[model samples]
Target: MGKQVVAESARRRRRPTKQGTVLTEAHIVETALRVLREHGSAGLTARRLGAALGADPSTLYRYFAGMDELTLAIGEELIGRALSGWLPGGDWREGLRELGLRIHGAYLAHPQAAVLTASRVSGRPREIEADEAILGVLRTAGFPDRAAVRIYHAFIDQTLAFAALDAASLALGRRARESDEERWESTYAKLPADSHPHIAATAGLLSARMKDSAYPAALDMLLHSAATQLAAARAADRGASGTSAR
Candidate 1:
């Protein structure tokens, strides 16, 4: 791990491509992102990345050990973009909510790449920084250390999990996506009310809402539940302290 970190740092310094284009690690990551966006996940091969950078595929090995490493780099870039220029506003709930939205938006913007890397643990600089920032916000909101850590883990995991799921839906082939939409409209909305009373009754609303993702509602529920837990913990602590005083 130490050696890999050192190598990553060195690669970020500078290098010259055979085509005379200066290739830094940043350039490689940026180009990789573009390739993922343009060609989709399967199109991110070393040969394709090399062609995009106007260099030999072997040139990429010097900066990244392999495609896995390069993929991690790209994932870190997505995380960095999500937290870029973000500052906590002291209200932890709103701060965390905004961060979640930013992360979700960034992933959805690069649906192909998000499907590839959203659930992977990069353990890179940006990923670490985002984790620390989230924990900090939770602690600032008066959560005890253990509670903060627990909530932080759940928050990050939930956000990434949803991002991956949504990205997968977005990354589906055009025909497949359309087919799903058509199913929701034609099949689901046409269910017999006698056989499936609930779904049939709400079929109209379901069809209208299926066009949008359910992430926002899910996120709100998670945050609300966490807030309730935090409040209960605080109340229990206060009661314990009063009892001890008596």
Candidate 2:
């Protein structure tokens, strides 16, 4: 009896639900994202997804093994969007900068989904493609394997970290978001000069700047540091070659 039940479950997954609605993997992933955006991660369940899809909840298992697999699919979808129509240009730095921003923007565009999936490791095609692209950009620019891998790790992590952080803020309710934003002007901007001298002095700048995402500025600093490292590595290589020639 138990074996029959298991076999039946497997059969159910192989075919669409009795609803006669043909559900594609892409369709299910997209619907999952919509459910995530409208209702959030906690609200995403088999029953909720079924209603959204106009099919049985079990139909989702036909495409994905389970919810964890679905989450990875959602993450890959965001990465795919980041890579959509994007090609690396002549300037590696510029290419990397654009890639970083695209990734950041993609996550911010789907803040609710980002909050759930940004930290996930999908290891899926889209994610793998993105990794390969970043590494290729660094290696083609003359970075050694070690340096390229190191920079790639930092670059991807920093971009996703900021994406997740910014997305968390963006995912908040309107009033909550406003209240958090307002704290900069209402609290930090008004700090008394005597006790908090530095903040008071830069309060005006802080008020203006703190209202925006700092990812761009942070990305620039990272790129600049990478440029410096590349320059130093080249100089060292040249020095070693000159010594060998002597």
Candidate 3:
């Protein structure tokens, strides 16, 4: 048992495999994502990854503890993509909106991977950085710590939730996805107004809008609410200042 542990540790320290291929953690993660893209989450076995990298299956253990650790790395990669080249501007609202959109876009770009990692809290560098950046935005915008934390929690959770939901739809096979979308037009649009009055009245709109992800609209609503709260907080602070002066 002791010898096995030492052997595994030695393998982990070796970067170059016997196949003459050098494997870095980043390279492994990139290969894993490609495997995910081509064959999906379930297909991302150690054997498959090793074959894709032209290395032995045991070579993967050098970088990742197991498939679960690799999955968290994949999730971190998505967050890194979202944060790449992102600079927060003066307007907190706009900055946050852009961040939210980038996150949603990154996940949707890799729907197969997103379906697996969207809900996993990686606690990795990229994820921690994103949380810090978001909190900084709210704090710099004059929100108190409590309010910033509350809004940040809701903002991040809502963004990931929508990303996972939309990714699931995108992960569906083409025929299945098309059939699902067609239902909005074929079934809902044809519903009788007498029985389903509200849906029937908005059937046209539903057909057009329901086919799209609601993340953008939902993000705007959340930002609007936060703005209102900030305004009220500012007013209360001013009133308190005035009372203190008197």
Worst 10 residues of 3 by lDDT: 1-10
What are the per-residue Cα lDDT tens digits for candidate 2 across 1-246? 111223323444444545555567777788888998899888889999999888878766756778888899999999999999899869999999999999999999889999999999989999999999999999999999999999999999999999999999988978999999899899998999999999999999998898789999999999999999999999999999999999
Tell me each candidate's RMSD, in Å, in order: 2.6, 3.6, 2.9
Best by lDDT: 3
Score each candidate by Cα lDDT. 0.87, 0.89, 0.91
Worst window of 10 by summed lDDT in candidate 2: 1-10
> lDDT order of candidates, best first?
3, 2, 1
Model 1: how far residue 22 lies from native, Å? 0.8
TM-score, every prediction = 0.91, 0.92, 0.93
> What are the runs in model 1 whose C-alpha is more than 4 Å off?
1-20
State how far residue 108 of model 2 sits from its true place (Å). 0.8
What lDDT would candidate 2 get against the real structure?
0.89
Quality of model 3 by C-alpha lDDT: 0.91
- Which tens-of-lDDT digit does each residue in 22-117 have in candidate 3? 777788888898999899889999999999988888867766777888899999999999999999878999999999999999999999999999
